[model samples]
Structures are given as C-alpha cells and as structure tokens.
Target: MSVRTQESALRIALVFPGQGAQHPRMAAGLYGHEAVFTAAMDEALELLGADGERIRSAWLARTTTADFDDVTVSQPLLYAVDHALGRMVLDWGVEPVALMGHSVGELVAATLAGVVGFADGIRLMRARIRQFAQTPAGGMLAVAAGLGEVEDLLTGQVHLAAVNARRQLLLAGEREPLDRAAQALRERGIVCRDARARQAFHSPVVDEAVEASMPDWLATPLNRPRRTVYSAYTQGVLTDDTALDHRFWARQAAETVHFAPTLDRLLADHDCLLVEAGPGNSLSTVARRHPAVVRGGSEVAPLLPDGAQDDVRDRRSVAAAKERILPLQQPVRA
Candidate 1:
C-alpha cells in the first residue's frame, strides 16, 4: 500500500479580519494594481444602487473615523478589500493552499473559496451587517495578559469572544456585562484593551440579526471553493462537500470565535505564510506574537483606505519579508 505523503509545501493562507477590522480607508491602494479588487468595489456600489465615486468618497472621508460602522458601508467595504488583495496575490502567481477569515472575514473567505459569488456575497453581507449593526446597545473588549486570570473573572453575563493567545482574550456582550468583566479582570491585575468597533461580534447579542438575516442568507447561491477554507466557527478547515451553511455563518456573528485552536491546526499542517490580506495588522500582530506561529507573510498594509503607508511595501520591508519566504517559494534548500 503506497501511502500518500502530504509534503510540507510552500503553503499560503490568505486571511481576513472580522467586522472589527473595518476602516474608512480600506482597499484604497489596490485600485489600479488589482483588477478584480477594483471590480469588487464597483460591484458593491452598483449592487446597492449607489453612485460609485460618491460611495467611495463618503467611505474615504477626511474624518479619521470608519464608515464601516454603518452596515451599509462595512459589509461591502470588507468584502472589497479582502477580494482585491486576494486578486493581487493571484496576479502575483501565489495561490493560497488554504483560506480563513475571522468572524465576518469568513464571508470574504467564502467568496475566495468560490463558496459564494461576488455579487451574492455583497447582497448577503449587506443584510447581515444591517442585522448586526442593529444589534441593540452592546459591544466587545479585549483583556490582555492572560486568559487564566480573565477567565475566572468572567461572570455568565458576558461571553469570551476570542482567546488570541494565553495572555490575550476578547469578551463581548451588552456594555454593562463587558464593563463588569473588565472591572473584575482589572482587579486581578489584567490589562484590558477594547477593539474600536461599535458592536459586539461573535456573541449571543446578535441572535436577532442572525434570525432576521436568514432569508437573504439562503437566497445567496453556495458554490464550491477553489481550495480548502477553515472555519472560525468549527475550529477547523471546511472540506469540498461541507462548510458552515448560511445559517451557521449568520449565527457566527453572535458566537465567540475559537481562533487560537483553529490556528493551532492550520500551522501544524503546512509551511504557513499568513498574509493579512485586508485592512490593518491586527491579525498579523497576533500571528507574529502567538507561540504557535513562527514565519509568516511579509506585507502588513491594510487592503483599504487608499494610500495608507505600508512598511512592508517599502523596498526594505519587502526584502525582509521576501527573505523569510524565499526558501518556500523555491524547492531546493539554499
């Protein structure tokens, strides 16, 4: 019996962030360099029956605030940025062996996997964002420097959102519950930091959103992915025949993400290069700091908000990141 060997290939994992990562300037730089990226942005505007330029400008406003806080804006913006960056990577001849998205980012990953089309994805995202945005007055916060200290402090009122590492944890719920949890953590000498989003994602508060958004979710066609896509909900990779159904993804907005465990399996399977394909270095920051990860992607620019400077895109950062990935891109040990 000849057993197949899954060689440690130079595998790429194109990752995107959840709604919390949305920014006003998302996907600004890829306008010219990546065609699909630009097309996705245009499609988003057109699908919503809005003027493309005006919509883009309103999102790119001078205020240092995010337009994505508006579900109408965030749903499309995140999809556009992630798809655009993935398109650019494809153009560069780099195909990811796997894909993953954090919370809402999973929708983008679904699109990349061909689990959904760009237009249908935009429509569904719009509905989903609206539901989540309307999730009553509640939100999420991050507690830094140890889950053990914070876990004991969390009462049943609030739920743990994500455990990024041993020391980093995210808690989400109504503001009051989060406040209580944060206060308790502080008493235990834990440093708590909050993410800059207006709503609590991946927690039970958005159950209403999930229920109401189901119609639109099912209306969208599910397609087969071009590759394997890992689920934040299931804490593992989704195979060709199965993935989180529409309802599962919708419910995800109201559940906690099992990020650390999902990542543990991803890194164990391949020679991973985790690229922050969308806005901000939030996910990249976690990956580099996580004990499970070692070498990762070189670029660290948010995919949107045109013209945000990237240290990685600079001549020097490119060289440094490339140096780390060079061996994997080639076959021989140099």
Candidate 2:
C-alpha cells in the first residue's frame, strides 16, 4: 500500500475536500462496510473522546438534530472521514502518486503522506478548531468575478478567501460587510451565494486566530512528505526549501487558497487520475471542468456521490480505479 512502490499501472492523485462539503451524515455508507475506514474512524473517535462520540452519533443516527456546520465539529470530522476514505482507496489497490488538499483537507494529506502522524494531526486540528471558535461570528460569500474584480470589491472589511476557478472567487469577513458586498454584487447582475460558514476562514479576519494558534502548530513535529504533496497556499508542488512550520500554517489560515492554480500544475505535469476522496463530488467536478484537465486528458472520478446508495457508490469507485490501472493494449499486428 506504500504510495512510493511504483508497481501500480496508474498514476493516481488523491484529492480531499475542505469544509463546506460536510453534510449531516457523511460517509455513513462506508462506516461499517469498510474495515480500514472503520478502524480509522474508531481511532479518531477514541482520540476525540466525547466530541467524536457526538459526531459519530450524528453520522449514524437514522434521524437526529446535529449541527454538522459548527466549525469545531466539522473540521475534525472532515479530517477523519477523508483520511479513512483515502485508506479505503488504498485498500482497494490504487496507490497515490501524489496528493492535494484544499484548505483544512491538507491536514489529511499531510498525515497520510507521513508529514505528520495521525495523533499529532488530530491534536493540531483540535487546536485549530478551538482557536477559530474564539473569533467573532462572520460569514463567507462566493461571487462570480475574477481576482481583480473581487479585490476591487474589498473595502478593508472583507478579504479574498479562495480563488476556486478563473472567475469563481470566495470572500470572507464580518457578516455585515459580506452581506453588503453580496447585495452590491447582485445589484450589478452578478451571481453571489452565501457559503453558510459560521466564521470567516482563510482571510485577514482570522489573523488573530492564526497568531494565537502558532505556538501549538510550531510545537507539533512534521516531516517531509513520503509522496508528492501540492500546497494550495503556494499553488505548486511542495519543495525542500518550503517550510512546513508554524509560519507556513499561520499564513495558510489567513491567505487565499489558490486551488485553481494548484490544479493546473497537477494537470499540466502529471498523467494521473484525480480521485476525490471526500463526501462529495464538488472538487471532482471542478477538476473535470478545468481546461488543462480537458486538454491533458486526465480522468477525474469521485469515491462517493451525495445521497447515493452505499453498494452502488463503492462498486463504481472500484470499477473506475481498476479501469484506470489497466495497461494499454499492445499492437495487434504481428
């Protein structure tokens, strides 16, 4: 299952989603069906204690009132589910050649890549959730504009949180300013949608949180990734000179996620399958729509779809991965 083994026919790329993709009962299908997934979830729950129990209960209940959107719960839960799904994919015989994660999802990639151990990664995620929970209530808005247009809309109140695509931008800040910006954009006939986030993430609004969490992040040990890991912060492949220290994560918390550029890099350089190992196919859809992906001819697939039957989704994922790894046929003529 070592990603570096180099025996697999397909060059697989594992991609994870960040926050906002979480739902009330994500990964319910895989929980008991996949042993590796179950083991990973159990380990994470044991580490998380009561908080983990709450999340697990919500995820398992046939019906219940659970707030999956709370930052404190969502971040760690997403990490655990994503990590378990990646492990399940490995168990299915597809080894990743590289890994990429958007926003908080990077922690999962880091842990799987050996950049950080599972226990330590969970601790960091918990510390991060605590730090962010202290921030004043805020929200995020997605506007249909390019970077320059979005930047012009910033009035010392809001900051660009993510550049998802060529013209897709996310802004985060205090609720009032964000609402005002959204109204203004709509008045101009632009499409804007509320992201429904409880706090402003990946913006200057979280600067204080970033500063407060520095000591914990710095104290955590990290190592070079065993597999290639692209950084959404840098929008490029992580290098030896790139520091995975506290300063790096501090900046990550307060800076825009350059996801489009990072995807472009992966598409341009790697003949790999883009496998979204998360609850939804949103990132997979984004990757499929990218020009580089269309031009370069890389396959994009999701491990699961929203609200799909458990057995169907699992079967589809296995079929897709197996098809991708099949060797090219030899010339028929003798």
Candidate 3:
C-alpha cells in the first residue's frame, strides 16, 4: 500500500476486545481462506507448543464455554485470533493510523504497534495468565451505572475494573462483596450481570499475580510504538516518554481500564474508522454508542460473523472495507 501524507492519510483505528467476547470456533471461516491469517495462527500455535494444541482443539471442538473460561486458554487464543485478524485487515490494505485495546487485548495492540515482538507478546501473555490462575478466584459484575453511582454502593472490598462507557462500569472483587453490590444495584432497579471472569482482573485482588509475573513481563523487550497507541492504562495516547516496561503492565493489571476516555481521545484527535478485530461485535457495539462516534459519523465494522456462516462473514468483511475507504478520503475535523 502507498503511503499517504500527514494531511491525507486515512485515519483508521483498529480496536480489540478483551475477555468476555471469546467463543468456540471464532473466525474459523477466515482461517483457510486468508493465507496471511492462516500463517499467523499457525505461528502462534507453534510458539505456544502443547498449549497451542489445546487451544486449537478447543476451537475445533466448539463444545462448551468451559473451553475458553480458563484464563490461560482464553488469553493466548484471543491474542492469536485478534492478531491474525489484524494482519488480514492490513493485507486488505486497510492500515490503521492508531490502535487501542480493552484490558488483555492491549497485548495484541502492543505487538502490532511494534512496542513488543510478536513472540515475546505471546510469552508475556502466557506468563500473565498462569500467574493470574494461581491467584484467589473472584468475580466481576457488569453494572449499568456511572462510576459515581457505582462508587456510592461500593464497600471497601470491591474495586472498579473498567469504565467502559458513561453507564457501563465493571466491578470486581471477592464473591461475597460482588454479590452484595449486585444485589444493592438490582434493588434500585439497575441492571447488573455476571461477567463470569475466573479472576478479579484489574483489581487489587490480583496483586499477588502481578508481583509473580513482573520478572517475565519486565524481561520482554519494548520500544516506542511505530503507530499511535491509545492506552487504557493511562487513559490517553502513549507517547515517546511513556514507559512501556514491566511496572507499567503490572499497574495495568491492577488498575481501572479507562476505555471510555481512550475512546473520547481517539474521536477528538482523528477521523477514525473504528474496526473491532475480535470474535464478536462487543467493542464495535460500544463504539457505535459513543456520542463522538455517532456525531463524527465514524464507521464501525467487525471482522468476523457471530454465527457459523463462513461465506457470509467473508462477504460482509469485504463490503465493510469497501465502505470504510470512501468516507476516510474526506477531510478530518476535530
């Protein structure tokens, strides 16, 4: 693909979803048809060794949710699929001007943006997952309330995991407090659903895991991102001076994911075409609802279909890409 000047470059933004979006046999259709995607998946499986086989079997079996419920299994599998899908989009000549990720999905963005090598990213994810699995098991609740509303109901035990949107907040902690908080929210006629997370990610409950996994995470080499990377960790764009080291990642695991702020920054800075490069439209759905996205007339698309229709999925992706190109040629305004 030819490079465009700063003024004329297509400001495309690729967004990835984290956990809670995984399902069996996701992107099974694109695997065989797209050579670049196939190579990426095969390489990821090879790097994973036995765990690779386990993920592959789970993908093929398409059986139970338990197959992906394990953090160790889900993290690597999601990374592999998300990375491959991003590569497939690039092969289609739809290069991103920026990238952002939700929670664990940041690993994929980091790799694509040249912050870390592909293999090292996978190793870091595996180590992170294993350490998380060793921690005390907890739960997360998706509360339909703003941060202020949820904080009003919080005890000393629970922590805010993610600020997804104005009304979408994820609360994480021990089962007892989580349940209590959910009950309290429900009593007020607020919607609260179980996130079904195996561990209390992005909360103080995983401090032990963060400490255990620090050495491996720090050992992984990192550089300045080749493209702009919006950080859920800092709730802004990652700059040259921003540290992309072990401490940063550890803090990320133990801090609230400021996804809404990151989205706001993306919309304010660029005329971005937001593409969800994961199993489902989870992130895309959220992007569409953002006031900035709606007012800016930003286009959002998903790379894979929710169902088993492989042919239809391919057609939709192609059509969406074609549609994205036209609007991207227009001048961007804040």
Q: lDDT: which candidate is best?
A: 3
Candidate 2 residue-wise lDDT at 248 = 85
Better of 1 and 3 by lDDT: 3
Top-down TM-score ranking: 3, 2, 1
Residues 1-334, candidate 3: write the lDDT tens digits: 3445556444778898887777777777767767988999999999987678877888756565574666778778889889998887777766677899998788788888888899997887777667888777677888888887877766668999998989998998878888888898899899999884777888899888888888887788878889788998887888766646668866677788989988988888776678888887778878889886677546576766653435556556755665765456445443
- Give Cα-based local distance difference scores for all models: 0.66, 0.77, 0.79
Clashes of each: 14, 0, 0
Query: On residues 157-273, what C-alpha lDDT tens digit does candidate 1 reach at each position?
Result: 677787766667788878887878778777877777667556766677767787888888778777677778887778888865555367675677677787777877787765567
In angstroms, how far off is 59's CA in candidate 2?
2.8
Residue 227, candidate 3: C-alpha displacement in angstroms: 0.7
C-alpha TM-scores of all predictions: 0.83, 0.89, 0.90
- Please estimate how well model 2 matches the true structure, expressed as its whole-model Cα lDDT: 0.77
Candidate 2, 289: how far from true, in Å?
A: 1.0
Number of the top TM-score candidate: 3
Report the alpha-carbon TM-score of model 1 versus the true structure: 0.83
- Quote the positional error of residue 333 for candidate 3 in Å: 12
Between the candidate structures 1 and 3, which one is better when assessed by TM-score? Answer: 3
